[model samples]
Target: MQLLILMVVLLALTTFGFRLGRGRAIAASGNNPRLLHSLPRYHGYYVALWSGLPALFLIAAWLMLEPSLLHSAVMSALPADLQGLSEERLALVYNEVRNVARYGHVPSTDAVGQAAAGYIGVRDTVFLSVAALALALAVAGLAFARKRIEVELRARNRVESVVKVFLVLASLAAIFTTIGIVLSLLFESLRFFQAVSIFEFLFGTQWSPQMAIRSDQVGSSGAFGAIPLFTGTLLISGIAMLVAVPLGLLSAIYMSEYAAPKFRSVVKPLLEILAGIPTVVYGFFAALTVAPFFREIGASMGLSVASESALAAGMVMGIMIIPFVSSLSDDVITAVPNSLREGSYGLGATKSETIKQVVLPAALPGIVGGVLLAVSRAIGETMIVVMAAGLAANLTANPLEAVTTVTTQIVTLLVGDQEFDSPKTLAAFALGLVLFTVTLALNVVALSIVNKYREKYD
Candidate 1:
C-alpha cells in the first residue's frame, strides 16, 4: 500500500511538472507560438522524464540488493553454535527467519528467527534511508530543471538521448543473461568431461551411472557411456517425426489449399486443441492406454515386447507434436505468393501437381524448420518417457524393447535426494549441455535453410 501511494504521488508530480514546463515554455515564447523552439509536447515529455527516472532507478537498485544484504547480515549474526552448520542447513534457517518476519509465523522455534528480527530491523532502516535519499534527489532534480526551463534550453534533445540509452540498456541486459546461462552450462559440462572421457561418454555402450559413494568403497565402476540414452532419444524423436510430419504436413496443406472456409474454421481450432493438452496427461495416456495396447498387439504376434516400450511413448509424443508442425507449416504454406501457384496452373499443372511441385517446394524451408522444432521437443520430453519407457538404458536399434532417453535419465538421476557434487547428479548438467547444443544447432541449420530459400523467392 505504501509503495502504491508512492507510485501514485510520483506519477502525479511528473504529470503536473510536464504540464507546468510546457506552459512556461509557451508563456516565454509569448502568444505567438511560432517563436517557440521544438514542440510543446516534447517539453512536457522532457519534464516528465526528469521527474521520474532517477528516483525509479534508485528504487529498483535498492530492491534488488536489499534481500541479499539482509540475508548475509542475518547469517553473520547467527550464534556460535550455528556457525558449524552446513551451507544447506544455514539456508534452511534463513528461510524460517524470512517466513516469520514476512508473515509473523515461524515454522519452527529455531535461533534463526531471533537473528532474523535483528536483520529485518537493519534492512528496514537501510531501506528508509535509501528512499529518503531518492526522494531528495528527485526533488532537487525537479527544482533545478524547473528553474532552467527557459525557452532556449534543449530539453527535448537531452530527454530523447536518455530514452535511447535506457532502451539499449534493456536490450543489453537480456543478451547478458543469455550469455551467463550458456557460460555456466559450459563450465559444468567441462567439469563432467574431466571425470569421464568425452569419447567414452559420446560413443561407448552401457550407461549404468551407479558408482561408489566413497573412495574407500570397493567394487565401483561408474559407466558414463551415453550412447544408449542418445539412441533412445533418436528413436523417440524419429517416431514422433514420422507421425507428426506426414499428419501435420497433410493437415497444413489441406487447410492452406483445399479446405473450405467453414471446414477450416472448425478443424484448425480442433487441431490446435491438441497442442493445449498437458504433457502430463499425455504421460498417463502413454502409460495406461498406449503401452497396454502395444503389449497386447505384441503378444498376439508372438513377439517379445516390454510393458513399457519406447514405441508407446514415442507414438504419444508424435501425437502431441502434430499440432506444432501443422500450425507452423500451414502458416508458412499459406504465406507463399499466389503468383507462383497461378504460374504453375498456367503451365497446365493440376492442383496436386502445382501443390507438390511448386507450393510445397517454396514452403519446404519452413516445413523443415517446423519438423526440426518438433524433433527438439521430442528429445527434451520427459513425463511420457518417464512413465511409459523403462528406466534401463538399452543401446539398441529396435524400438520395440524398453529404452531410456537423456531427459528421462536426467529426471531419474536428480529426483528425490541428491548430492550436487556427485558424478551421478552432475551428469544431468552434462546431458543438459549436450541437449542444449544439439537443439541449438538444429535450429540454426533449419533457420539458415529457411533464409536461403526465402532469399531465392525474394
Candidate 2:
C-alpha cells in the first residue's frame, strides 16, 4: 500500500511538472509556441522525463536491494545458534520471519517473533527513507528542467535520445534472454545425450522413458527412442495443416475478393473470434465431442478408431488455427496492387482468373508466412493434444490412431517433484531443444521464401 501511494504521488508530480514546463515554455516564447525551438509538448515531455526517470531508477534499485539489505540486518541480530544453522535451515527461518512480518503468521519461537518485528520495522524505515529520497530527486529534476526550459532549448532532441537508448536497452535485454534460453537448453540436452545416446534418441523406435529406481529392478535401462514422438508430432501437425490450409485460404479469398463490405466486416471478426477462444476449450470440445463422434462413425463403418486419436485433436487444432491463416492472408491479398488485377482483366481475363493469376501470386509470400506460423502453433500446442490425443507415442501415419507430440511429453516429464539429474527429467530439455530447432528452421525457411519470391510493387 505504501508503494502504491508513492507511485501515485510520483505520477501526480510528473504530470504537474509537464504542465508547469509547457506553461513556462509558452510564457518564455511570449505566449507563442512558434517562437520556441521545439513544440511546447516536447518541453512538457522533457520535464516529465526528468521528473519521473531518476525517481523510477531509484525505486527500481531500492526494490532490488531492499530484500537483501533487510535480510542482512535481521540476520546480524539473530541468535548465534540460528545464525550457525545450515543454509537450508536458515532459508526456512528467513521464510518464517517473512511470513510472520508480511502475513501476520504466528512465529514458532520468541526469536522468530522478535526478528519478524525488527524486519518489519527496518523494511518500513528503509521504504520511508527511499520514498523521501525519490521524491527529493524528482523535485530536484523538475526544478533543473524548469530552469533549462527556454526558447532555444532542444528538448525534442534530448527526449528522443533518451527514447533511443531505452529502445537499444530493451532490444539487448531480449537478445540476452534468448541467448540464455538457448544456452540452458544446449547444456541440459548435452547432459541428456551423455546418459542416453543421441543416435538412439534420434533414430530408435521404442520410447518408454520409465527408469527403475533400483539397479535390480526390471526395465532399469529405459528406452530413449524419440522417433515415435517425432513421428506422432509430424502426423498430428500434418493432419492439422491439411485441414487448416484449404479452409483458411479459401475463406481468405472469399472475404478479401468477393464479400460485401458489411458482410466482410461482420464475418471477419466472427472468424477471428475462433483465434481468441482458449485452447483448453477447444481441447474439451475435441475430447468430449469430436473424439467420440469419430469413434462412433468408425464403429458403424466396421472400422476401428481410438477414442483419443490424432485425427480428433488435429482437426480441432486446425479449427483454432483458422483465424491465423485467414486474417493474414486476407490482409495480404487485399494489399495486392489493383493495377495488376486491372491489367489481367484488360488482357481478356475474368474476375476469377485475375484473382487466381495476379492477386494470389502477389500475396503468396504472406500466405506462406501465415501458413507456416499456423503450423508452428499446431506443433507447439499442448493442452488440446493432451486432452484429445492420448499420450501414446505411437509411430503411425494413420490419423485415427492415438498419438502424442513433443510438447505433451515435455509437460508430462516436467510435472511434479523429480530429480533434475535423472534422465527422465533431462529428457524434457532434449525434447524442448528439438522443438526449438524445428521452429527456428521453419522460421528460416519462411523468411527465405518471403525474401526470394516476394513481388515488389510501387
Candidate 3:
C-alpha cells in the first residue's frame, strides 16, 4: 500500500511538471511553436522523463538491496549467542523476526518481540527517508528541466537520446541473462559429471538414477545411463511428428487452395483454438480418455499394451501441436505468389499439379520451419507425457511400451525439496544442458534447410 501510494504521488507530480514545462516552453517562444527549436509536447515529455525516471531507478535499486541490508542490521543487533549461531539457524531467526513484524505473530520469547518491534521501526524510518529523498530529487529535476526549456533547447534530441540509451540497456540485459543461464547450466552439469562418468551417462543402456543415503542400502550406486531417456524422448516425439505433420500440412493445403473464404476463416480459428487450450487439459484428456481407450483396443486385438503408453501421450501431444504447423503453413501457402500458379496453369497444368509443383515448392521453406517448430514443441512437452506415458525409462522403439522423455525425467528429479550437492539433483542440470544442445542443433539444421529452399520473388 505504501509503495502504491508513493507511485501515485510521483505520477501526479510528473504529470503536473509536464503541463508546467510545456506552458513555460510556449511562453518562452511567445506562444509560437514554430519559433521554438522543438515542439511543446517534446518539452513536456522531456520534463516528465526527468521527473519520473530517476525516482523509479532509485526505488528499484533500493527495493533490491533492502532485504539484505535489513537482514544484516537485524542480525548485528541480536544477542551475541544468537549472532554466533550457525548460518542456517540465523536465517531462520531472521525469517521469524520478519513474520512477527509483518503478521503480528506471537513470538516464542520477549527478545523476539522486541527485535521485531525494532525491525518495524527501522524499516518504516528507512522507507520514509527514501521516499522523501526521491520526491526531493524529482522536484529538483522538474525545476532544472523547466529552467532549461527555451527556444534554444533541443528537447526532442535529449528525450530521444535517453530512449536510445534505455533500448541499449534493455538489449544488454537480455544478452547477459542468456549468458547467465548457459553458465549456470554448464557449471551444475560439470558438478554432476564429477560424480558420474560422462561416457556412462551418455551411452550406458541403464536409466535408474537413485542415489543411496547409506552404503548398506540396496542400489547404493544408481545407474545414470541416459540412452533409455534419449530413446524414449525420440520415440515419443517421432510418433507425435508422424501424427501431426501430414494432417497439419494436408489441412493447411485444403484450406489455402480449396476452401471458400468463409469456410477458411471459420476453420482456421477452430484449428488455432486447439493451441489455446492448456497443456494440462490435454494431459487429462490423454490420461483419462485416450489411454484407456487405446488399452482396451489393444486388449480386444489380443495385443499387449501398457495402460500408460507412449502412443496415447504422443497422439494427444500431436493434437496440441497441430495449430503450430497448420497455422504457419496456411499463412505461408497463402503468401505464395499467385503468379507462379498462373504460369503453371498457362502451361496447361491442372490446379493440383500447380499446387504440387509450383505452390508447395515455393512455400517449402516456411512449411519446413513450421514442422521444425512443431518438432520442438513435441520434444519439450511434459504434462501429457507424465500423465499418459509412465516414467519408466525403457529403451524401446515400441510405442505400446511405457516410457519417459528427458523433460519428464527432469521434472521428476527436481519435483520436491532437494539437496543440490547430490548427484540426483544435479543430474537435472545435465539433462537440461543436453536438451539445450539438441535444440540448438535442430535449429541449425532447420536454418540450413530454410536457407537452401527460400524463394525470392520480384
| Candidate achieving the largest TM-score | 2
User: 1-458, model 2: which lDDT tens digit per residue?
Assistant: 99999999999999999999999999999998999999999999999999999999999999999989999999998999899999999999999999999999999999999999999999999999999999999999999999999999999999999999999999999999999999999999999999999999999898888898778754478888999999999888888888889999999999999999999989999999999999999999999999999999999999799999999999999898889889978987988888888899899999999888889988888789888888888888889988888787788889889988898899899889989998889999999999999988887887676555555543
Q: What lDDT score goes with residue 15 in model 3? A: 100
Find the 10 residues in a row with the least total lDDT in model 3. 449-458
lDDT of 1 by residue, 1-458 (tens): 55676678777878887897788778777855566666776777777777788888888888899888888888888888886799899888888888788778854766766876886698778877876877776676677667777677777788789989989999999999989989988887888888888898889788988897676644166888999999999998888888888999999999999999999999999999999999999999999999899899999999888888888988999999999899989988988999999999999999999999999988988888888877888888888888888898898878789999999999988899887776777888889899999988887887787677678767
Please give the clash total of every predicted structure, in order: 0, 0, 0
Q: Ranking under TM-score, best-scoring first?
A: 2, 3, 1
* Residue 217 CA displacement from its true place in model 3, Å: 8.0
Model 2 deviation from native, Cα RMSD in Å: 1.6
User: In candidate 3, what are the lDDT values of residues 1-458, reduced to their tens digit?
Assistant: 89899999999999998998899999999988899999999999989998999889889988998898888778888988788899999888889999999999999777778889889988998899889989998998899898889898999999899999999999999999989999999999999999999999999888778887688865479788999999999988998898889899999999999999999989989999999999999999999999999999999999898998989988999898889889988988988888889999999999999999999989988899878877877888888887788888898999999999999999999999999998888999999999988887777777676556554542
* Candidate 2 vs 3: which has more lDDT: 2
Per-prediction TM-score: 0.85, 0.97, 0.95
Ordered list by lDDT, greatest first: 2, 3, 1
Q: What value does the lDDT take at residue 82 in candidate 3? A: 83
lDDT of 1: 0.85
Model 2 quality (TM-score): 0.97
lDDT assessment of candidate 2: 0.92
